[model samples]
Target: MAKAFASQGDMADKKISFTEVGRDLWAFTAEGDPNTGVIIGDDSVMIVDAQATPRLANMVVEKVRSVTDKPIKHVVLTHYHAVRVLGASAYAASEIIMSDKARAMVVERGQEDWDSEFERFPRLFQGHESIPGLTWPTQTFAGRMTVYLGTRRVDLMHLGRAHTAGDIVAHVPDANVMFTGDIVEYHSACYCGDGHFGDWGGTLNAIKAFDVDAIAPGRGDALVGKALVGEAIENTRDFVDSTYRPAKRIAARGGSLKETWDAVRADCDPKFASYAIYEHCLPFNVARAYDEARGIDTPRIWTAERDKAMWNALQA
Candidate 1:
């Protein structure tokens, strides 16, 4: 029998953990689901990547309350995916931050993404109806912006496009902790549905330039030390390479999408088969890789209609 479309069959709930990754940096992780990063400064708090819905984000809020009462002054968007940004209202933050490129993507396809992702992963959108609306970035930067909460500094930089064209990483130079949104996933499968495989590799290199002691990734466990951080970075790179390399070869040889998918699955499954979201993301990952390998520089927007059509074709 064919597999269930995307994550429709994934109904199991995951336990959430909040870990202090650095001096004042905290990571809120859910097994292998999307993760959120927290930074507490002397006077205020900043949250990276809000959860999918206000109700779900309330869990992160409760965790933040357990640590500090410094208001959640800012919420940052690593990219403009619904699961990442729709919960911005829960914080009532004074500023919602994202790259200008990210804001443009929201204007272009935010609604489509909202519908497409909600349909694919209903478990993640537990309180979808509670979301006020699309989260808008109050502040957008072209390349880099430094936000200071009293003496603490949070550097938001768009190194390059990886998971999405608007991806950004937050660096705390003093504490040496970096919140690398979806740009660097630890053990979790890198969802490449809207990714730029070639550019993502380069972006990972740029992330390596930072002298980070700890990193809170988009998914999986937090990297608490430099050694672990290095391993996580390489692991993420390995995943991308293992998936895209084979898919690219197949695509370049004029092979069909199924052939590309089969080639990548055969090569990467042994290594990443147990990773979080591996099964859910493989079809989309292979689809994007196949397109990029064939000279499609920009990722096509994934609509609800497109998602179903693609899933049906690929699953069969």
Candidate 2:
């Protein structure tokens, strides 16, 4: 059992732990590790967000088997991040699904993201060889889709952009649970370089309208109670506002990216300083916030070299 978030310190042996959230819903979590949600219907199961590699994803398979033998008939991608989408084949899912926009993101920047993320976090991609190729959805939906396991309904909705343009959430109305891709992370510094800050707050509100009894955030522990659900969304909103304010202040004053980072760190570090992957996320978050503040409507492509250049310019 690896202590959670040891990846934050480059500890190589950290393992993940998955928690059961409801009767047939399990929230797969690790210490600050990316999360995967398991939704069991009457006869089949669906996995939300595949892990970084097949080897890592198999660990979730083991955890799922501990509870049920039902085959995972579907794999629902919350977004297109390599860590979340690459190891999708490990599941028994015959039908892999994602939003229409998610499919386009893969078309647009999948390869670049794959390289960039590998450089940013090597520990997550332990079994890199197992990834066959860029994951493609067997089925894609535009606005919303309803999946059924007998009578159980899984409502997959694109509730506006937040973590990424293609970000979506799965709401089990009966269970009143939602799996928010990277849109809702608990006690973790959100990796928001690919995010839309202005719209994220609206997206959170959209999720809350579902009146979820519990939440399996993209990272961190499952929200056990309704009150905790509110807290998680609030914290996520705060992180965006905090990052944006400083970045905007710097942009407005015509300051350089380095100065923007410095301004943002004074507030973010003191508060989210100890969050999971806090250091790893700072440079990227600052870049997105800075660009958005300067009227950059679209997110800039983030290559590995660009990631390093930004980190050096801001952190060093």
Candidate 3:
């Protein structure tokens, strides 16, 4: 039987976990679903990534209220993916920030992404009707910016391109913890649909240089301790390398997309099959890897129609 298209079959709700990786630093994770980071400062709170919709984001809000009554002052978008940014309205944060490159992507392909993702995975967008519209960042920075939440210092930097060309990491210096959006993941597949395979490793290295004590990764459990942090970073690197190498090799030989797909599965399946969204991400990852190898530097925009076409062609 043919596999389901994208995450269409993944409708069951995932159990959510809110873990504390540092003093007042929290990670809201949902069984390998997209994770959100919460950083509580002296006076207010800073949210790392917003959930898919207002209803979904309210769950995070509820979690926050349970701990403290501090108003959420800032919403920092790690990148411009629909699942990560559409719920910005829920926070009512005074400042919604994104990297300059990320904002450009929002202008270029945000709507197409919203349409594509909503079609690809229904579960994430359970409260789609509540979404106000395309989330626009109130503020943007070029390379790095530091925000002081009272006395606490949180540094947001675009280390390099990994998951997407405009990905950023939020580092809390006092806690020695980092909220690495999707630049790093633990026990979950890195969605490389709009990724830069060549620059991903270097970005990982840039993150490693921080030697953070803990990390709230994009889609996995909150990582605490230096040992676990290093392990997750390396594992993410390996996952990226494993996916790209076989696909690149196949593409170099002028192989078909299906041929590249088979090669990627042969290499990645044994290792990543049990990962969350591994199957959902494989086709897109393989397609992007193949394209990059064939000299397509920019990832093609994925629309609702394009998503179905790609899934059908690959699953055929």
Candidate 4:
């Protein structure tokens, strides 16, 4: 029997947990769903990644209300994914920041991505209509940008391309905590649909070098101690390598896409079965890994049509 494509059958509501990873850094993690990071400064607050819809973002806002009434002045997008960026409008923030490359990616395929993702994960897009067309970044930086929320300094750096061409990480030097967007996910499948495998490995090494005590990764639970943080980083790197290596090997040998997909599943599913989105991400992850291994440096744009074609071809 053939299985449903993507997350079409994943309708169960996940348990969400909000924990503080640093002095004022909070992580809103929904089981294996996308996690949102909150950085509260003396006078204001900054949200690392917005939820999927305005209605969903409202839940995050309510959580913020529970903690403090500090105005959410900034919404930082870790990358240009619809699930992460579409909720920017809900925050009513003064500044919505993202990397320059991310802004370009939005301009290039925001609409396609919006449609493609909404179809892929219906549960995440609970209030899909609440998303106003596309979310654009009001401010964008090339490599690094620093913004001070009252005396607390938040450093946003684009170490290198990993999950996307413009993935960004938020570091709080004072607290020794970092908010690594989708660049690093703990106990969750790394969706490499639009990722750079080789570059992603290097980026993880860069993040591992940080002298941080805790971390709020893009997904999974917050890492409280240095040991747990290191473990998450190592596991994430291994996940990326495990998936890409098999697919790359198959591609190098002129194997079919189905062969590459089978190879990846056989190699990684056993190790990552308990991880979130493991099955949902496997097909796209293998496709991108195959393309990259075949010398395609830049990731191809994913559209609704292409998504379905690939899914049917691989999963059917």
TM-score of each: 0.98, 0.96, 0.99, 0.98
Model 2 TM-score, 2 decimals: 0.96
lDDT of 1 at 170: 96
Error of 4 at 304 (Å): 1.4
lDDT of 1 at 176: 90
153-260 per-residue lDDT for model 1 (tens digits): 999999999999999999999989999988888778999999999988889999988868999999999999889999999999999999889987898779999899
Q: Which ten residues in a row are the worst by lDDT in model 4?
A: 85-94
Clashing pairs in 4: none
Write the residue-wise lDDT of candidate 4 on 205-290 in tens digits: 89989968999999899999989999999999999999889988888779988899889889898899889888788878989999
Off by over 4 Å in 2: 1-9
The alpha-carbon deviation from the true structure for residue 200 of candidate 4, after best TM-score superposition, in angstroms, is 0.7
**Local error of candidate 3 at residue 50 (angstroms):** 0.2
Give all candidate RMSDs, comma-separated. 1.0, 3.2, 0.8, 1.0
Model 4 ranges with Cα > 4 A deviation: none
Output the number of the TM-score-best candidate: 3
Candidate 2: tens digits of C-alpha lDDT, residues 190-258: 998999989999999999888788999998888978899999999999999999998888999898888
